[model samples]
Target: MAYPRKPLFAPNGAVATSQPLAAAAGLAVLRRGGNAVDAALATAVALTVLQPPSNDIGGDLFAIVWDGERLHGLTAAGRSPAALTREMVLAATGRRAAEPVAALGGAQARGPAMPARGWLPVTVPGAPAGWHDLHDRFGSLPFADLFTDAIGYAEHGHPVSTGTAIGWARAVAGHAGLVGAEFAEFERVFTVGGRAPRPGERWRNPDAARTLRRIAETGADDFYRGRIAEALDAHAARTGGLISGDDLARHTSTWVDPVSARYRGHEVWELPPPGQGIAALLALNILDGWDPAGADPVERLHRQVEAVKLGFADAHAHVADPERAPVPTAALLDPAYAAARRALLTERAGDPVAGDPERGGTVYLCTADAGGMMVSLIQSTYLAFGSHVVLPGHGFALQNRGTGFRLDPDHPNVVGPAKRPFHTIIPGFLTRDGAPVGPFGVMGGHMQPQGHVQLLAGMLDAGLDPQAALDAPRWYWHAGRTLLVEPELAARPGLVAGLRARGHEVAVAAEPSVFGYGQALWRGAAGWVGGSESRIDGAAVGY
Candidate 1:
């Protein structure tokens, strides 16, 4: 069922994103003499308008930027509202106490848990600040110009894509029973005639356009300290929400050095703690001990899944905000630690346990410019439609990132005031011998790093082209020893049987989105080559 597609080549620039329009928006910026950072910021803003179910202006953002000479990492994830506390959250959920994932053997939390969508799970959105900071550091074009396409689409309307339509319906269905006043604005802003828009239907949001204009004009100050913050505070006071103007004003995105692990002959890079980018690095570290270059398909997959399980186990155990608690980043990425973890991966899939390292959603996009600058960026609202708490006048939803917090009091990521919770969205980049290769990323909740591991193996080890690597059948280690594979992968001549023989609870998934969608850009001798995700409506446009 593979489609005939080749990587697009461009001498000057390239942009890839989940939506065709978003990619085009970035390309337009490149054509306007904007650098890769400008193109990336343009695309990121447009996605908030074009793909509302996946991301919005009211979300978290992380990025790895190659500004020609070196790499820069930005983590714009927001902290919990100062008004919120662990005691209040526990009381709200009616849970006397909570159990850690270690106690549950990495099973999805059962019993009382944080609400998936509500004012309770909402946190300070850091994307607006992220956009501002990235531009201040790397942009070559006027900041206001980046919002032109996004604002135009928001005001004039654009046809919804198939994948977005499906997600829109699912989100509406998921929140159908929420009739609270806090949820009313969401229904009004996102729906037409009380329902999600169908594919190709024109969707407009004048309010969102206005808000984007304010951010563009004020350089995002409006979002954190001006009118937008006042409006959000007023809404929170009226509703039973926790966020306040102080929380918004105090939010600041951090710039950190990118963490990396050498894989094959290249170095894979991601942002550090509090975000799960380390999980991909951890998995890669363990995987580096053995060369799966020409191994059997089953054996390669088994090792990949096993490494991922161990990575997630440790990530879930230790990854928390370093500002709040200690995160042994160096210890976790140590070569010796990886060797010790690799030894545990036997012929059989064993229950993964924490080895004292650490842990760590959303949309992913990559843009490359003729100047050799590349940007890998990811942003998200946590879940489909986020907390489903759209701002009344602004017409955007806030992220439910607080849900990533553990309810266990002893956990490093426990819910607390002004502390960032665990983040799922991560952007990745590749380099060899200190030279830039390209920027790449996958977008899904926990499937992000898993996608990173699988995608890299295909491109680097098997020598598949970027498109082929993305098109290849995928697998996800859901929880425990259970493994979810696409129907195509299951049909791969005894692939399922082989995995099951290794004590894996193999389940063939019906939906392809469960494996996530990704985009990649590779720097070749000829030019910049790019690949776009085929599982959804997307494009890789260059010139």
Candidate 2:
């Protein structure tokens, strides 16, 4: 199993992404003397152009980068607008107290707890500012150079990949036309003739190109405090939304230290609070107590599922913006907490109670340069097309990330001025003995951290190579007892029966794509090995 099934090996540099164009764009940058950071930035921007349904200029961004000596984590998630509040949403929706996520299906004689796709949940976008912060820190190429390929694709056109086309169609059906008249712009721009583009269809966005060109020329400041911000403010004002010019001007991405846990001999790292990355660390810490190699596949899945629940319970209670509600990243990831939670796991799924912690559509890419620099970056528009309130004339949508904030004022992640919500997307990294091992990540709404735990276990415990680790069938646990198993995995004779016997209410995923799409790069003696999830239109490329 350790043998790579479809590993792509490279020597000087390597880049992997969920889209071939994005991967190639990054690799081309590296080939042209760009470092890993430059390549990662290129790929991230290209992803926004190539996969609009999953990631776009509208979303948040997070990254874990290893620069030979140290690992740096970035929090690029946007905060609640100064003018926005939970009460504002309640008022706009005509409710005393807005509904919660649990009452998502049209509350009993009540409007939905929160607006899933509208300006009510629009937060200030941070990806543009995030790109500038990253480039300012580690880029070797001109900031504008990083977006060249992405701009070309946006202005001209590119053939849609099978997966992206499928996802785009779903977004059209799910996010567009469902809101109100304001979302009409989304239907106009995202769809072709009022329908999602079919696979192989050529799509272009000159508006997005113009926006990128502006950012390229003036840096991301144009997005945060300049023209784009003005447009956002005007749109918000016209649409009765919350974002203000002040909100955009005050936005800045935070640079933080990476939080990590040791699994076996290697260290697994993730971005700290406000993101669900801790879920991966917590699960790994809990799994560290047992001998994974000795456990059967069912046992491994069961253990990870249980540990994730505990992590979520704590994260929901504790994880929030460091400025608004500082999370004790060190204390939360302490060995003692994980060990105590580990002790609660038994033979079957347990209704694990939280010790009272705390905490999308997404694109994850990784790049490794010959100079020993590696970056694991992720970005997302939250729910497909994000808010569905496309900014007319600007060619980009705004993120519904604010929907993540709890309606409860007592909650740590409750909506507040300039507070980052409980973010779902996280980029992951690995190292051994203080040396960089590589960069890795999975992207799929809440399935991100879940995928991280599964992928890390597959490689660390089962001795699977990067590709085999990614290729392994996936299982996701949710809402307590329900376990969604991939059909490929459900077909495994005893797997379903075994899970059901252990108290899991098993259901095979009708569309396995939601499990997640991942990209990974492993650095070792030979050079570099990269893996892209088999379920996407992705590739691992290098020069």
Candidate 3:
């Protein structure tokens, strides 16, 4: 079946998003002589104020940029404070590391009472550092100009899109009691009639507006080391949290080369080791040996499923911080290794394996300007509202990315002072010969790799347009056991049973199962073509 909306194919500049307003804001920036980096920065900042439930300024950011010829990955993820040790947390609570505390959704949960609050979900905030770093490197306009649209939205308010409203309603109802007073204030600004504001409803965030003004005036230092940092530190101390002013001041974003592997003559690039982008690359590498071009429908689907499993298995075992794990990057991407991995895929399915959740709630944006600069950017609060701890006076929630760290001392991703955790959120890009093909991202946690496979298949093998590739039916291996197929896919009567006959535990999800929010832009003979996911309330706009 075809998607409801037509595919967007632009020949010049284009922007796609989960919200039209956000896309328009970014497009406006591009039109005003800002490059892709500036447009992406503007969209990210606006999302923080407008889509509070899914993302925020207090979250982490990751990106892959097409710097003309090669791709570069930036790990804007933050780490625990230097003073934060597993031993300290254990000592404070007098509990063993592996012992299960209250379930995240259960009564007596130790973290913040509300899911949107900053206290329950605080981690090092990374977006500010990331924005500054990207601007310093590739921006054309003044740094302060990037905040104009975001600041205006935060102060004067923007209409809450349908997607934002749904997410906010869920977060407010699920986490109201868990959050502290600051978040309560946030709720007041966002909620209408004691619930999330519906689509087209104007929503303002005055506190965030003020915070943006401060950052524009004083630079990111106001956030990393100045008054905002002081407020964040004081709030943490009063709440018995571990973050300190020093952690805020010391936080920095790292720049590295993106990892890429060839598939069907096109090169797919993604963020390296710590992020799961490599997992997606690994999966594509394994599938490279399979003749997806001529395979029957069932045969093609089986190959893709097997590739996902093998890639995820390797991810669970090897993907972690390169600094700590000595990740065998060369070995894993080796053609021989891919051939060996592909050998494990039979004509049938098998038992599922559970994958870790890196960052769950996040937003992805891609932009390109007339200057030929392009950016694939992602930002997240880790989980909804992050640590759910709203900093008292800053109006920013913190990230809960610390959850990705393991308590096991032997694990490569073990929690330690100032160590980056295994990251799940990653941005992707593609190239042919030496030119940029598209900037893309898949947002759902473990579903990201699987989403990449499908998107690649649609674009490269099936010849579908970018929006069609995104709106196509998708499947996910949730918790590694159940195959939660999208309703559209599940409509095929014998498909689920066929997988079950092959030893797969198949289950039908009530909704669309795993929804992947993605956007893409490809260079056509004339110019650039872009498509935003129709499953979301986003739009693709260009000149």
Candidate 4:
């Protein structure tokens, strides 16, 4: 029988990434005898150039790698600048630290809540640190070798992908009106002729090329403790921003033990706290007892969304910097806790409050080499252009990841000095009976875990192929029963009716608010089989 969507198969190697150019970059590295780690870095770096709207060198990085032996996790997310304190933020924005973050222009009526659009929302960038850390450990290629594709694309040019074009234009439209110089840097880098780039239009960033070269030659030191740091400091000082050379110099990516949970016979692995990976595991854990395959299509999807709602609520309460997080990682992922949380899901859609749990885009790439090495990596510039503050001379955009923090001083993720805020982007991996299943991930904002759960259930429970599982109609449970379901699901005969009967406000739309793009690659009996996102301009390549 043929599958709903065909999977790309390869024996020597395979790559699945959001951008075709970046996937080619990885395939090139693999052809040169580079391992998965090298190819992954190359792909990641290339993306900072090709998919400039979604990610950049300025964002943080996270990855889960299987080096043919043990799974290794890397946390490259940066900390809040030491100079940035609750008092300082309150003084700058004139809002109490304890107040809930106001909407952009809500009557709670203050400046945009919690630095939603500027330097104050940017943490020290962690991408360079992460690249260096990955290379220093598992990479086979020289550091500079990874930059060739990225530099070429940035200096010469690259054609915008469909997904990237949509995102780029949306970002430009969102920030069209800003009075200050800090915001001008963002407009300068992303907009051409005061507009988002048309799809297939050629774009170049020589400034980013120069910056990448400096990072390449200096071994990433320039980004943290050297000239790169100086430029960042000068920008921050001039703009009255809190970042400094010390913040950049003090940053370090940490090596961490990955967390996992068993769903049926398969083990799903994700990065630990400070990331929302646990949320995916939490949802899966709750659904482990039920046989999703036995349920009707609507029933299966409803259970997944319900479980995710519970997981997100707990995450809101418990997940944060491990240092300040109220809920311990061990307690959060305990099967017993997941079981209890699972009980909250019922026949109707109702917002479930967290008892007291603990808790958590941009691009997701999975590359596998012949040697059995697989890397699941994700990086992103939070909130479009990220802080909407680009350095004048440097080519990279600063991530507004600091916007992930809470303004409520009592919250676990409350704004504080050097604290890593709650993060949304997560990388996922799967395995069965001690053997490698392969690397897989879905990229979007809060939609990541929801996508992961749906894809896994489609394959593991519903017996669908990789491509079929990914291409299957998806539902985005934004909050409670408010759902944005793909039009495909609407046409599933009675899928939408069943869901609406269960109290879900299902809005059937083709785009339904960035439902997320996914990529999956696993060790098949034949070789490596993989697939890319259908919603974007990309493909799965094998060789």
Which number leads on lDDT? Answer: 1
Candidate 4 residue lDDT tens string, 326-401: 5577887888898787887898876654322111138889999999999999998877767778898887788888
Instruction: List TM-score per model, in order.
Output: 0.96, 0.94, 0.92, 0.94
Q: Tell me the TM-score of model 2.
A: 0.94
Off by over 4 Å in 4: 1-5, 97-113, 353-361
Give the alpha-carbon lDDT of every model.
Answer: 0.88, 0.83, 0.75, 0.83
Candidate 1 local lDDT, 290-358, one digit each (tens): 987578988999999989888888787788899899988889999999999899899998876432211
lDDT of 3: 0.75
Model 4 RMSD, rounded to 1 decimal: 3.6
Tell me which residue pairs clash in candidate 2: 99-113, 314-357, 314-358, 315-359, 316-359, 317-357, 317-358, 318-357, 318-358, 360-445
Highest TM-score against the true fold, candidate: 1
Give the per-residue lDDT of model 2 (tens digit) for 420-525.
8878888999989988889999888667778998898889888887888898989876556888988878988787898889998999886757688998999867
Per-prediction RMSD in angstroms?
Answer: 2.5, 3.5, 4.2, 3.6
Q: Which stretches of candidate 3 lie above 4 Å from their native place?
A: 1-3, 89-121, 177-194, 356-359, 510-513
